[model samples]
Target: MSIEIESEDVIRLILQFLKENQLEHTASVLEDETLVTLNTVESRDTFTKDIAQGRWDTVLKQVSHLKIPPRKLMDLYEQVIIELVEMKEHSAARTLLRQTEPMFLLKQHHPERYLRLEHLLSRSLFDPKDAYASGMTRDKRRQIIAQALGSEVAVAPPSRLMTLLEQCAQWQHQQGILSSDADFDVFQTTATVESKEDADALANEIYCTIKFPGKNAYAECSLFSPNGQYFVTGSVDGFIEVWNHSNGKLRKDLNYQAEDNLMAMDESVISLGFNSTSELLVSGSTDGKIAIWKTQSGFCQRRFSPAHSQGVTSVCFNRQGTEVLSGSYDKTVKIHGVRSGKSLKKFTGHASFVNTVLYVKDDTCVLSGGSDGTIKMWDVAEEACLYTINPAMNSSAALAVQSILSVPLITDQVLVCNKSNRLALMTMDGKVTKTFSHGKEKGADFISAAASPHGELIYAIAEDSAVYCFSVASGSLLGETKISDSELVGISSHPLSNIVACNDDQGHVYCISSK
Candidate 1:
């Protein structure tokens, strides 16, 4: 009986030891399955609370004193740290995870979000922790992008274009997420050019006028050049005239007069352009033909007959001057090679007669407007319709977009005319930064628009025979010139001058100086 009492007491002491060490439940459950009910939900909750509230620190310190493997302790720390981080208790969360170092898991699950968080943390380390400060940072970031990418380019269709814009928005969203402060600074910019120029100093201006010595009336002129030195003008007189605008001298005038040909209408020269080297003049006439004329000497180089059923309205030269694009009253635009003068491509998406086409730089993109009251972007390379410049919601849909002129005024911004007595300053991506409207004048129609060589001012001529100037940045009307009683259908600003030249509905032209 004495031996039995000693053995039972020893067992009791061991049981108490296990309980103090937090292994009592496990030991008891292992001894008899029926006793496992002691490790019930309520008991487990109490145990976990004790472990979570610093009681486990003492137990962990005691465990450190034991001969346990360092790896096992690290595993426990990782499990606990992951739980804390998942619960938004990041500080404590980081402490636990750092012990085990599960960085790969964090990076894999959240790349962009984690990047943003990292940015915020870095910012906070050097700055104050004001949440609103992030707003200002976000604005600054946007200003930087807007300043750098001042214009947006329209590449694909409306759907794809929307996707690109959304990416920009996403970038902006990330910036907002990464910013820690909102009240840092506001930036102010100054104009580079003076607001006024002395009248006497404006003598270096250019004065251009269209003169026709032909029998047929000079209905209209599409004036353009490869090099500014020599400009080519097309008129209703069935002629394309290349002039030395550099010194106000006539260079070469080539007439494509039909011999005794019965089918030839050759009504007039409606649109014209010069090849890159200024060696070939491409003209689209009232008759359905596109004619290429040699520049060095007046001669017919080649002729293309994708022939508009109606009148050809506009023609343009691609940046390389290898391709010629024409828009016609038959509601089609065609692309042809300069060397062969053969139709290489054609665009027929416009519902109404296509009026004007502008090739953008060396890219295959083209901007076209027509009587359909729509301005469309096309990729001549892909032969795709990218998108249409959405007409302003409040404006009349009935207002025809008779013409469109795109002047790359700034690096990424284009100045445009829509024939609605208004001008639009837009990004290549189709975002309108500003619009200038010529309020309703009884008989006025905004016909022509051109950007100054310096890109500081934009000049526009109205059918009411008035030429107006506006500040490109501020959109303020700077000046105006009233010249003729007939409507001014065309206008060109001198590359080196304050002088503006304009043509009227009657085919007469004038040169006026702002001075």
Candidate 2:
């Protein structure tokens, strides 16, 4: 059985929420100290009945605070005034027509109706039952009127806090700080944005710069968090650092030191990746060590020591975050379960050092590139090589693949870069569909590359410290911005905004804005 109150109010609903959740002491304190309240309606049933039964006096007394439109109020007045005339209460009907401001406007705008009322008054006769020609009873007419005003007077759903946070999330997404496809927990996360309106499309200039702690530390690899709040960089000096997204400051709090006086791995860091939610981050080192850290606390949650006999070149987590996919100079790719701390499967047959590896086709396949100038697709379940991509066989390029990048939010296509004079977009198989090239007679090869989250633009960093921008659809060069005198070795694009983080071999990470 449900009990009914006169009406719902904020404080009472809050109290009910508190008490229902076993927060009696807090509820008591809230009830005793509460001053804020919702705009309350008393006995909503009786109030609605007064309107539907044509008790205009009662309704008129309560309607002012509802803030219903003046036009609607005028219609209500006309209904009652005509009913009074039908009831032979001419003086009462005339008072509303001439005295009330809304009724006065209605009379001025509709002279013919006013004239009919005057004629009826002159005749001294009318029918109360036939006040409306639509044949609706007076009671039914009032019910219809009440129904029309139902939305205006009815109380809105509670929990203004959630509504406000949801609105904020939506607005931030529209403002381009949060991508239209990404959202955040407003209660726990504040939208930290350094975006400009013009930069929403592409980035051309360096926005800010962050240098590693040591002058000689080179950032070998970099990547952004999924939520776009932070980005992590792997340096040649055996340190993996995380930085704040909106500012170029180091997030020292996320630097977890496993042992006393130790900051990172014993060997130089080579690659890095964030799990789907950014809850965990996995770092691969030059000496074939892999460390998974709790992102929030920066704790070394797990490690796979000597996962490969040589340097771990690239690393990422499966979408479920339960498994890790890694490639190494050992010329092998392997999947390791995070919980069991065991190697699950290994794919072989790359003749040289594997440069990169990633899971594709819904985590059922492994794709890898190698220094031997070939890219191989392997079936994850069967541990068999599906196909290999050798660029020399299909194009006039001098090399195969140095890196393979997945276009964010897009499946079936990935960006491929190599020592060749061209960059191409290829499918999960070995077929190339689009290629990007330049006529600047040069021997500078692309060391690293990243694509826009929506697959609109491509940012490839060359060994000459030049960042080339290319249109994904047209395969045309949009522009190029040189970042440093030193060779830029790595690049990472923001997951949501038009910002790219590129790092040089001399230890500086430049955050460039599309605006």
Best by TM-score: 2
Angstrom error at residue 61, model 2: 36
Error of 1 at 291 (Å): 1.3
lDDT of 2 by residue, 1-515 (tens): 11223433546567555655688788768755764233235556776678887787878767754556666777677778877787788898888777887677777787766666666666656865435656677777788777656545655355544565578677556434464433344554434333443223668878789877666777888888887755888788887777765667766544343222233788899989899888899999989999998766667889999899999999999999999999999999999999999899999998889998988888998889988888899999899998887864365544746889788655798888887657888877667788887656476667778888567888888866788888877889998888899877888998767888888878788999866
274-382 per-residue lDDT for model 1 (tens digits): 7666677777777778877665455677788645778888877777777788899999887888787578887878888888887774556887778777778888888
Provide TM-scores for the models: 0.54, 0.64
TM-score of 1: 0.54
Worst 10 residues of 2 by lDDT: 254-263
